[model samples]
Target: MNRLVPLAVVLGLTTASCSGGHGAGSFLPSGAPGAGSAAPASAGARTTRSTAVAAPPAGWATTATQAVSLKSATDLGALDATKPVTVRLGLQLHNVDQLKSAVQSRAVLSPGQIQSAYAPTASEVAQVTNYLQSQGLTSIAAEPNGLMVSATGSAAQIAKAFDTTLHAFTVNGVSAYANTAPAYVPTALNGIVVAVLGLNNVQAFATSPHRGGQAVNHASPADSAPAPQPESPCALSSVFIVGLPSPQPIPTPEAYTTGCPRNYTPSDYWRAYDVGSTSGAGRTPIAIMAEGNVSSSIADFRVNEQGDGLPEVPVVVKQVGVASPDTAGADEWTLDMTASTGMARRVSTIYLYATTSMTDSDIALMYNRWVTDDLAPIGNSSFGGCEAFPYLDGSMLVDDEIMLMGAAQGQTMFASTGDTGSFCSVGNPNGVPGGAPLVEYPAASPYVVAVGGTTLWSQYDGTYAGESAWNAGGGGLSQFEYSPFWQSGIQPVGTTATGQSFRGTPDIAMDGDLQTGMIVYIASAGGWTTIGGTSLSSPLAAGVWARMLQNHPGLGFAAPQLYHTFAMSNPGTKLLGPPPTINVGPFHDVVSGSNGAFAATPGYDYTTGLGSLDVAALNAVIGQ
Candidate 1:
């Protein structure tokens, strides 16, 4: 059973033409905001600008206007003119070239260093703030990094200020508001203010959480008996298998039978992934990008830790915007906390960056906090939206900038690739099975480690048995984002419509099949429940990453090193001649199964990416 819930927001921005190139060398196109020419002195050092540019007058002139489209939604009418709205103005970066170069070199800079060298200048911030104030908008504040400026006003005020119209609409029977026309900026803040977010309130991201059914005993076919009751912490010996006939649909759980698979616990993951004798040990701190009140989740974590006989990890909640009392995402947040901490066993701290809502604007703030705070070296985002929406609205570019800064600061975030196989879902809440081929954003962004799903089979003792790509796992070529430098030579199943190679997901895989779901404690649910999805896979990856960071504290971004390690282990020369007798690598390369359009292969494939990790082996060679 799939439970679709609001998790994050999606905001829109004006799209710009990008230059065609390979690797990090091709910078943002000239038309793109924040495109700079200066190069930093060193990866860790600050760059020196030749001269500052003067700000333009606060006159109302046409800047780039964001094209808006209400795909498949019914237009109701104009939104309430007096309705209050909050919008975020994305500012241009100071040294875009330098920031890209620093990230490419794997420079480990601090938050302060990143701000000093690459953040928007005071003049740029002032330009945007001045423009907003001139338009009669209030509560104008700029982020410390100067990447975004927030303002509040009524729908009329916002529409007038950005030269657009706000109209009400019903999307999948849900009320929503969007700009009827393109949203533009004043002439003064043309390139300086890249994107205007929050002009429309659209449900952008959907949480991927699939609940498991009662344990079935498939051992006896002739013996007709009642299904087994749900176990609090499922036994390790009750292994589940996929590909069997199910009473429900593809994503839903199959009918209960005898001796079927059960949910997995923290200890089960530790043993299955070969994470022996390694805890974060208070060295690595991680963050969870979440929404609403997670107080119950914290309580649930403590309950899980005590029940599992594990050490308690400190959790600090940081309210990004206003404190939201909404607990709609209780299962998702709780699963993130429990699954992540459960995998690492222990960590220095668990920071929850809870936002007011799951809107694109609010979620952007949550991500910005995680990057600018620089407290957590690793973070987990178990939510995402279709890549096309963000790309069209410009949040993709906005979030990508934040992630670039994160990469330069040696921070790694893991995001779920979604749960609807190779295509995006159009259904409300839990994604339906069909739509055009598109990957999930944040995950599609080259900066994050896009985690996919797998159906894991373990031994009776919970030791590693084998894995295959989960049928419903989200993985495919990106519609907008280009492939990063590390993925240069990799040949996935297909190419972009233009016959070019774009970014493909996921970067890695983990257990996400409902039949092999993790045993989680949801306070609101009143007890333990088995849940799966890319949501489960992402936090699990983050926890494993925390353990790796604990062992090697100096490791920077993980993708480059991960690809390099895989390439070293499997040489083309050897693969071309014959299949290697022995497989040698930090990852357990999954060579079976498919996620709709793509299938897993010998090396890197679209379905499973670089496959699942061998924690011990990965930790040993990640830093080297």
Candidate 2:
């Protein structure tokens, strides 16, 4: 799941390549796009039919035909003067085969090569390093594939290190190119090493069954199925949802961004939330945190239909981030913090003020406002800070405060599991003595239900068609102190030491793979891009919980009670026991996928935890 797709998946495009103009209208919101819903299928067909399967070339995923402009780097003085940042430049190797045969017979680093044991050697590493040395850049890390190089002298001096060119043609039969001789260099100390994943297999789709509610067969295929189990009834819990703005079309020249699916046609998301046939919706004042200008996205969703023939949840927008006039870095993330409509609704905007610029106090201030002023029972956070544990600590503090505030007013706080699995190297403070693996922060926090990821494949006929752990799913045992409370029904099946290990993530899951993912249209970015990640799942669940609370107005804050009611209780109890329905239960145990070393098994796997929700069952249990 930590693997990053190489540029190859981007249609052979690279930072250097560019495609001839395609009609902007060709792009539509994600999900089964018009007649061309199978565009990905066609593109994949082209790959298998055309390219030779003899191991893909190094930088195999590099897709673009042109170099990404370093002008932004130049204007921002990306490169530092004096003490140049030592960065492990992520690049696609132009000639991996030649380099591999020249070096290791296998070319790629043997499995035992890297620390986490996954990275392969990039052909560009050796060649680029050699070229850099010729220009006076020195090596720091002496890894096999690429060296961690330090730029000597000024930004301009470092910029001169990048001097080369590359070329390629587009999938649409157009030519494109990239300039190696970058005019500017990056100045930030953080140098991102971008790894291109599988080039030709990128996919995005929508999986809502017939609008007729025919109980669409939701079974995992043979190749990707969970161990066989008895059938259970539908867990019709309360459904909640938030709406986002409709996406504006991305113009040409920069139309590639349109590859992303935009918002669902008016009804997609809300309908999905209504799985449980419960009514009355509860007293939980579901809150949405947003930064700025999402009025259009929300309005579009409101007009959309829920499956049962209703508009998306009714929402009231309010400002909560930095003052509207302020545009500082903190102000940006503040917007996400303040924007509170989506988690319970499944749609909302990521406030710009939510970035690292805002202080914990600033975040706390925003939280207080949403609980007190905005009248939300639970605040859904779909974002997180850098891999630093301190950030998690601050978030935990805010969460605790929000919970307390919500308790006084009867609300709960929810946050998304961070998306930084590669940075697992970051240690956690509350972890075991032997230095446990540090899971994502805020999610790892005791107060939060650390969400995880999964890959969903539609069951065609009677068998599974395609399924794989979502390449981007995150999961793992907590390096931080195990919050035993979060570990209720989760028990080890394999090795007691392993299964019963630290508290893992993803209390629940929903559709999140970019392919089969929900659609989101962003007018700000002005394009349609398919979006996925637990960021999407957590909010969807939050919206459901909000609705459940709304329907059961007397069900005081459910955070602490959810664990007691459903977690580790007797099998007879709705939590561990058999769900009321004997046909299909609310939860679909994820017996597949893995986050890192952890695999999805019988009961709980890092990939999907307690499977997905039994909304109906959830409502029944909570309402009891």
Candidate 3:
């Protein structure tokens, strides 16, 4: 049996996850009340109890003044609505204050209302729309979700006015309507989603009974915003591989346990190292985007094992498959099937599926799948929407709103480049034909670190070979303009800055081959079962990144560090540069393998760019 990867030795805690249960296992939050926790006074309106009962809503998607509630519409700023605007409502906010408390002074609405306990009444919509029309706002779609108001006004002025009202209104000693704050709003074009926070926080039945209570203080607090502090720095290290022993040829019962060899045991592994010092108490949230439910699975792991205890947080899961509790969204299973990997934290997977009823433009609702109050880096998407050209209509918008904005807001996004070896067209496997080589959507997104697949060989004695291209890894010139500055080192073949060679992909690699795949059990379809793919690799990387972020609370986004540590310096600089030599120590050069037609030539090749990261080196870079 192969030895357990160094994670156990260094971190001292072995956090293991199975196919079905909550990752931290028996340790699921019981929803018990805490001392400061408040109870919701009514079902629809924002209440202390309401905030604690469910996940908080996301921020408003508007300008300085015109932004709306989380339930209102999509943030069109990511796109130039001066061109065109699309609006849609998504996400269910369980607690408004809990979310607002995180941003204190910027509190706009209660969590309960954002979740729709208090959507606007038909009469209320007419009132708001009439007001907008009087103010010259046109192209309005006033639906049950919220109002979608657009006009040619200064975005800044409109946003400011909107926020003033959202943050000042209150009823019966609680925030009346609850919407997200302005900071969370994106840079939209002419489109704006008018979110009514005060009203959304309550149910009509509840609001009538509490009409005469003391007004709540709903304005942005002078000292409530987070204090100014240094931006945390971080670096991307080599993606270490812990090769799982393959299961029995016939797949026996013992194949998934410690009784089996190192590779076959546990079916999955979660790297567990303590973050923050014993005193400072740094909290690292593990956000997962998967299918079905893993609560039972996690509870089992905690009850059955002896460890630091299962991840401590609430798991708020929303089903997204067709025939959902809510109709506005798509079925989540189809999307979940493509995103079913496990994590070592309190895991909550939102189910979602693209449907015929969902217009091609209504894709923004997809971002609501994993937005929650427990802040943590999320394991990213596995499957992507179909696209024929370099760009997909709905792809970038979602990436901009969710992935880019999420990363900018301090969440790390890990995505799979593609299974097809490179973006150029290729022959189909199993006799099915392959589409023309096109850069995969989202993965090709500039904000995310596009991870590719790799194959590895475990020597008979145990140690594994350095990573090599998985023969199916994706890479190629990009179809879009290069967004990040660090992309300089990766010049696409056969073109200058002005040509097709401008865009590139597969920022890094991990073990993604089925032969040398990971040991994972999935509980969705039925009993425990093993599975692997670039899908597994993405989450594994995300979990590891969570640990790293926990370790370095000061870590900023990883993009800057990638270039500062690796791309900027070359061979000779190893001896020169500053004291903490960036690239030379942290990275492990992948000197072999290939992704089918693309050879993993020495140095930077299309297969694996600058190689994978080293944990220790990564820690050092993040520290810088």
Among all windows of 10 consecutive residues in model 1, the one with the lowest summed lDDT is 40-49
- Global lDDT scores for all candidate models: 0.69, 0.35, 0.35
Stretches of candidate 3 exceeding 4 Å from the true structure: 1-282, 291-314, 318-363, 368-374, 386-392, 423-436, 458-464, 481-483, 492-501, 523-529, 568-584
For each candidate, what TM-score against the reference? 0.82, 0.46, 0.49
- C-alpha lDDT of residue 575 in model 2: 22
The clash count of every prediction, one per candidate, is 17, 120, 79
Query: What global local distance difference test value does model 2 have?
Result: 0.35
- What C-alpha lDDT does candidate 1 achieve relative to the native structure? 0.69
Write the residue-wise lDDT of candidate 3 on 507-613 in tens digits: 66655655445432222323222233455445555544544665666454454455456654454343211111123445545555667656665455667665555
lDDT of 3 at 346: 30
Rank list by TM-score: 1, 3, 2
For all the candidates, what are their Cα RMSDs to the real structure? 7.8, 20.9, 21.6
